[model samples]
Target chain A: MKIVKYEDIVLKVKLACLQMTTDLPQDVQNKLEMMAMQEDGQLAKQMLDIIIENANIARQENRPMCQDTGMVVCFVKMGQNIQIEGGLLADAINEGVSLGYEEGYLRKSVVNNPIDRINTLDNTPAIIHYDIVEDDVLIIEVAAKGFGSENMSQLKMFPPAAGIAGMKEFVKQVVIDAGPNPCPPIIVGIGLGGDFEKAALLAKKAAIRNLDEVNPNEKLLALEKELEVEINNLGIGPQGFGGKTTTLKVNIEMFATHIAGLPVAVNINCHAARHIKVVL
Target chain B: MATIKLETPLTIDKIKDLHSGDQVLLSGIIYTGRDAAHKRFIEVLEKNEDLPFDVQGQVIYYVGPTPTKPNQAFGSGGPTTSYRMDAYTPPLINKGLIGMIGKGKRNDEVKAALKGHAVYFAAVGGAAALMGKCVIKAEVIAYEDLQAEAVRRLEVKDLPLIVVNDIKGNDLYVEGPQSYLKEHK
Candidate 1:
């Protein structure tokens, strides 16, 4: 069995947190540059220019890109053949988050309770999902999810008979409904065919995927292209100022579900699209 | 859209001249408030208690900026979604709050109140760092315990924004898209 120290995970997460906040991933940057070239509206293009510039400035100055630095989300893929020495994995992750947010001077955006609405101050209790795998590798995928785009996400359980057309319409409707709120030139993530909660989770993970990563399945890739086009056709554009470049990309992740249900979820990721991955 | 500049304490006459789609640069003093502070503002209004700051001819920016880093005036400060404030806006407007800076769609109530009364400006949503640089000075004037949600007085210079909604009921969120679609077609 492969053994790793607990501090290693904490250290990696801390660095990832700082990196994700200060740097806009190159894949997202390339997509924004391409979309900026394609944008038709004068104002939309101008907005994209400023966004790209802001990303550059953030990286150069070592500053957080947007004020909403986001709630931490870690996707941990644990190996069955490995054991972590020292502290609990969850606690280590939260510690790394606190250290990173505080040290990096990123915003403390987490509230302790939904209703009580008191600030957590440290931005802790990260949302974590675990998957057990057969290997010795512990893969940690971190995403800082800003609530602006997260709040615009949608989920629907349609009858099997509702078919692809209904799925398309609903996804499009969510983008339309979101408008300028989530900040357009948004990435659209669709999760199809899973059970209710699974679909929502899949949608979120899909949203965090790099824009350059196309689905391996030929059919899914084609659907992604179609959805991307349909969304851009709506003219929501950059910051919903109106143009031909509404969505940077559309990512759809699917799974098999019971015959009785057809569940779908849509998660919107703003142009920032912050995420990082580490394998140990 | 034309570019326009407006100083602080925007007057009704100046606000009347602005139609939707004009690019705006706001300079001088403004107050920052978000969901929690707005709620408190309304509660204070209800109790006939004086607001921590005067409301007349003032602009409220819907933002909760990151805490300032060393030697920096402020952290990345940008507009939050405006529609969330839709419920609390009318009361603020009734008290002569004339300008608001934010992003996203506003409801019918906000539109009705803005007509012949106030204007709404759209700051680029994710352009926080750029906007924060425009804030030359910031101080938490009230609700310190609310932390980021505190009502802070900020001195800004040429903070770029778009006149999304103005008196006479012009809404860029609605009209900007429709005009673009028609022109493209």
Candidate 2:
């Protein structure tokens, strides 16, 4: 069995968080560039230009891409053959998040309690999801999910009779109702089937997938293309100013559901698309 | 297609002349507040007490900027979603708040209130780094414990904003898209 120091994990996690938030990913950059070329309305094109310019400034100056530095979400896929040599895994991750937000000059946006709403100040206790893989390598993905788009995420437990077409309309309506609120041109992540919780998780995973990545499964890939075209046709455009390219990407993940269940959840991320992954 | 330069302590007369879709370069001091700070401002009003800062004819920008680095006036500051503050907006407009700067759409109540009274401006939401460049100074004037959500006074120069809602009830959120759809189709 291989052993990794807890401190190293913390350091790596911090860098991933900072780099992902500070620097817009290449996949997102290229997608935006293409969208800028295709944009019809001059106003929409100008807004896209400003977003591109902002990404450049954030990368050059090492500043955060947006004011809502967002909540830290760390997805860990742990290996069975490895042992961590220090404190609790979640604790180390939280420590890294706190330091990363601090060192990056990112905003501390997390509150201590839902109702009381006190600023935690350190941006600690990140929302972490874990998976146990059958290997000796540990993979971690740290993402700063700003709430502007997160607030627009929706989950619905539909009856099996709702079918695939129903699911598409539901997801599209969420984006349409969201309008300018989620900061379009947004990325749409749809988790088509599963139990309630799994559907939500799959949608989030879909949202975190790189904009340029292709869904491995062929059927889902087809569905992804169909949904992507449908969403952009809504004419909700960038910043909801109206034009082509309402969404940069639409990714879908799926799982088997019970006979009577067809749960669907949509997770929306704005053009910023801040995420970074590392393996050890 | 018109370009306008506006100063603070805005009177209804000044904002009334503006219409939806006009571009404006705004300068002077604007207050910053989000959901929590807006709620607190309402609370102060309910208690019949003065707020930490004045609101009359002042513009409140919905932003919670990142922390500033050394020798910087501010960090990456951009407008947040506006509708979150919808419930708290009319009260401020009633208190002579002349302008609200944010991204995204406003609710019916807020739009109704803007008629002949106030205006809403749109700043590019995700363009934080570029927006921060326009802010010449920033200081937290109230609710320090709220951290980024605290009310701040920001002095800006040539801050680019588009008139989203004007005094005559012209709404870009609705009209801008309608025109675009027509032109493209």
RMSD of each: 0.9, 1.2
Query: What lDDT is obtained when candidate 2 is compared to the true structure?
Result: 0.89
Tens-digit per-residue lDDT, B1-185, candidate 2? 56899988788878888988788999999999998999999999999999888788899999999999998899999999999999999988888888999999998999999998899999988889889989999999999988888899999998889889999998887887788878877
Of all true interface contacts, what fraction is found in model 2?
A: 0.84
The local distance difference test score of model 1 is: 0.90
The fnat scores of all predictions, in order, read: 0.62, 0.84
Name the lDDT value of residue A178 in candidate 2: 90
**Model 1 per-residue lDDT tens digits across residues A1-280:** 9998889888888999999987999999999999899888989889999899889988998888888889998899999998989989899899999999898888899989989877889899899999999989899999998888989999999999989999999999999999999987899989998799999988988999988886999999999999998888887778887888889989999999989888999999998889999776
Kindly give the stretch of ten consecutive residues in candidate 2 chain B with the minimal lDDT sum.
B176-185
Clashing pairs in 2: none
Off by over 4 Å in 2: none
Instruction: State which candidate has the highest TM-score.
Output: 1
